[model samples]
Target: MTRPPAKAPAKTLAPVVLIDLAVLLLAGGGLAWLVLRAQATLPYHWDWSVLPQFLAYTAEDGSWRAGRILTGVAATVRLSLWAGALALVIGTCAGLMRVSQRLFWRLCGGAYVLFVRNTPPLVLIFLFSYFLSGQLISTLGLDAAVAGLPEAQRPLAEALFGPLRQMPGFLTAILTLALIEGAYMAEIVRAGVQSVEQGQWDAAYALGFSRRQTLIRVVLPQAFRRMLPPLTGQFVSTVKDSAIVSVISIPELTFQAQELVSATYRSFEVWTLVLVLYLALNLPCSLAARWLELRLQRSDRGA
Candidate 1:
């Protein structure tokens, strides 16, 4: 007979920790008191009045549209979507190469993962922007192409990637984010693939499936299911990590936040609102990841 899972420790799932509830409350209250005292002493003028203006404004065309804050949010979502998709593609390919039988492929994958994961993202962005993207954009005349894009397509293009003028910088950010995220996602994919039973592999081989066919048809399906939780976590991570590209002035949330602070001198207010916006964007992703993890756990128990 199989052994049953041990009962979880009551403390682990307990809603309230009565053991130190008073101490916890006292500490929390003390922190809040300290913050209120500091704010009182600070010379900063907190103007929340300008916040609504930044959230929505009337354009020169007399059409009401999103202001800097919402525009930044849109830019962030667009950057994350494009970068995350490319990262998934790069990660899947590199991850499969990691588990390949061929020595050369394994070496290539290892080198890629080693190089990217070891390098700091700040360094990666600067290096890629100056060395790679600059060359490609200038050589391909992407700016001219963007500028020459028909007016009919301009609205869609702007919606997807901000203004045409910003396209070169935006593309660079997308490339860098995808490359950085891909290295980590590769390991997730590898671990998920390896989680499958060796017996399953042997059974597939017994049925005359080629290596590629087995991986594609059988292993991938199960592995992808297992990968869903971590994949969603990585997707969240990508959205958060997109903030790092602000150094390159890609006009994502952080960059726009900086711009607003400069214009309004409401550092605390701007950053607090940014915190809220980031929470709004990432909280759903986190909840979805949690649900996926729980679902996977339930499936495992059933199996």
Candidate 2:
């Protein structure tokens, strides 16, 4: 038998989309006009001469890729990666604890969530920097070992220390971002785990699976799929939050931007460049997360 003919796709246009585009264009034009007018009225013009110099090298500050900019970017990326990893570990444990039968585990998880949620992130950073971190560093003695490395290993030493030498400056920044992010991630994880049908747990138990086996084989895999989108979002947030470390002089992007602005006295240019740099780092990740989310959703629907 011959197959039936396929129907043609209907042609349609949404008026709302056109209206939105027109409004956006009008607003953009207005903003551009305002900026031009403001620039013309300025008492001093920006020296375009420094633009080429900035684009080339910042030799005066002894940095070829502009003073501290690459260092700041590296530091930000390092801190973000480290903090995200730490947050995942912490959040998973806390999430598991929140759902546990043990009172102590539940209480510990609850306390962490409440404390982190109630505290402002900046204050948390400060607390870690000045108070908790000293105790932690003393307890760990990690700094002493770092400082005790031999002269032969000084290159290795400096390479490691270049990003995080401060007693608690780097540690505090990492911990602060991790702690704050972990609270949100804990909730995401808890919800993902709980979203798995109770029937799965019962079936695993009926099959004589141990608690660990059941969690590892059945619950966690499903939970992880559900958790990926939120986790991706949290990762992006962590990158942005690394900027807050500048307040404590951890030498991340925002701090370096401030240094540039102070030295060049070009606040607008410095800030705009910093904004673009952050967007460059973050926008692609956000896009990837959205794409992954859509892909997972489609798979879920098909399943």
- Tens-digit lDDT string for candidate 1 (125-223): 999999656798888888889999999999999988888889999999999899999999999999988998888789999999988998998899889
Misplaced by over 4 Å in model 1 are 1-31, 59-63, 295-303
All models: lDDT? 0.91, 0.81
Return the lDDT, model 2, position 51.
40
Query: Over the full model, what C-alpha lDDT does candidate 2 score relative to the true structure?
Result: 0.81
How do the predictions measure up, each by TM-score?
Answer: 0.86, 0.83
The regions of model 2 sitting more than 4 angstroms off are 1-24, 41-44, 47-66, 150-164, 297-303
Clashing pairs in 1: none
Error of 2 at 296 (Å): 3.3
lDDT of 2 by residue, 183-301 (tens): 98998888988999999999999999988899889999889888988898888999998898888888888898788778989877767667787889888988998888788889989
RMSD of 2: 3.8
